[model samples]
Target: MLLDKSVNHDEVLLRTLAGRNFYASIQTVVKQKSDGQLLLYGIIEDISERKHAEQVINELNETLMKRAQELESVNKELEAFSYSVSHDLRAPLRALDGFSRILLDEYQDRLDDKAKDRLSRIRKAAQTMSGLIDDLLQLSRITRVELTVKPVNLSQLATDIIVELQKEASEHQVSCIIQDNVTALGDAKLLRIVLVNLLGNAWKFTRNTDQAVIEFGVRSSETESTTIYYVRDNGAGFDMAYADKLFKAFQRLHSANEFPGTGIGLATVYRIILKHSGRIWAQSEIGQGACFYFTLGK
Candidate 1:
């Protein structure tokens, strides 16, 4: 029973009975009034189950946090290993490619036409291999490198990239357009690589088109966060049937004879987007055109 206001319970202590036969708590106090009197109140509750549940919850949370840390450590090791392999292998491979060319250049008269042709093919293959290795290294860096996101002027970025791409080769009259003043916070350099690859492909695929058109700009989706920037090109588009395989490493939509590439550019681009915690996808028809959609920022 709860005692009246005359009793004091704040000074109570949880304890057992004097005989140690049952669980209970009590307090003794003296009240001041016209007549001084002593009073006592007792109260108690069983907290064993609540204490056990709290301990269990703490243990489970600790285990989950440890597992998450372990997984993060594993991913770091894997990324480091990948970067090392790509960077280390490229040096000697370049030597092989260069020496082979030197052999052909100095000893052409000592060899037959077929031998010379085979040597040329070897050089081409080695160059392509070197390009593949370089792309892989870039991909690893994109994954492991720390991102310094800052407000970037998309207007200037696109203009500079398009100018450089035009200078890379002058054979094609590529039509370039920047449709919007897209701005966002992200790693400027990585975004440039993404743009270069996308624009390069647009320029490559539209070789057959007399008026090869490639446009870059901002795009909005229904949701605010879903807003993205994209590149669209009028090129020899691929079959929609194999769309899923387009971004996988070493996956190619066209024959090497028809188009020359290591088949890793799109894959690298995909990885960069993923590292930014963004999405990348493509839309294409057999011969119509292709549109590459990618998230540029948060």
Candidate 2:
């Protein structure tokens, strides 16, 4: 190559006499002398350390990609297994409930009060099991569903859920305050589910309160850039000691008799929040009230 007045730089791999390979950065400068002769000046720098670091970063990226793929595959398999098992378990439960109902309806005259009570208990247990199975299936489906993210009007969702709850129990006197124009970026369907569970829990827990009140609103975080949304209710709250178990499946702080539930609603809500890269937590005191706070990822 002909040498010009301009400087040139290049990176290349070099091998030593002992057959050791390394990377080098070379810079060359060319000039013409007064005697009409060309002079060449060059500098070579060993860049082996930089090249090694780059190679390590590339390898780490590849490993992370592989691990992510494996995890996705395993998650899909687990969801499918859970779905199949839940469906299969429903059959036996249905049969148990049906037979117990038949005995109670047709053979009630021949059976004593004690026997009838046992059969009724059996039927009730079967029905509870069926509810648990349905909740499990819902959780499994939510885990695998694809998220279509967009702007969601959370205020409207909470209002709609409250309306439904009121329709279900018209006799219950409850006051609901929903802030207007509270929005978020998330999957509309999944976010709706979150509101339904939170609002539904609030409605149920406040059933016995003399003056029940539920509020849905948002607040800005001084320490963080994201907005914090919350659902607050003046109803039967739980102890803070068991807050750690709040988001777990089948973990209930209260007895079924006090507040009937499948114990999977919060778990489903937790999973949906995680799917949106968000977090959920609650604060409450016994007989006081409860407030659930959450933030969605950007």
User: Model 1: which residue pairs collide?
Assistant: none
Top candidate when judged by TM-score against the true structure: 2
Top-scoring candidate (lDDT)? 2
Please, what is the TM-score per model? 0.75, 0.76
Please, what is the whole-model Cα lDDT of each candidate in the order they appear? 0.79, 0.91
> Per-residue alpha-carbon lDDT of model 1 for 1-298, expressed as tens digits?
3334443333332445553332223344433454544354334444545556878999999999999999899888877787687768777777877888898989988988998888888788888888877787787777778888888776678788888878877877988888766876778888888888898898889988878888888776676666678889988998989999999988998998998998888888888788778998899997787999888545
lDDT of 1: 0.79
Off by over 4 Å in 1: 1-62, 65-69, 72-76, 220-226, 275-277
lDDT of 1 at 185: 72
Query: For residues 1-298, could you state the per-residue lDDT of candidate 2 as single tens digits?
Result: 4457545558899988899988888887887788978888888888999989999999999999999999999998997788788768889988999999999999989999999999999999999989888888889889788999999999999988999999999999999999999999999999998999999999999999999999999976688788899999999999999999999999998899989999999999999999999989999999999999999995
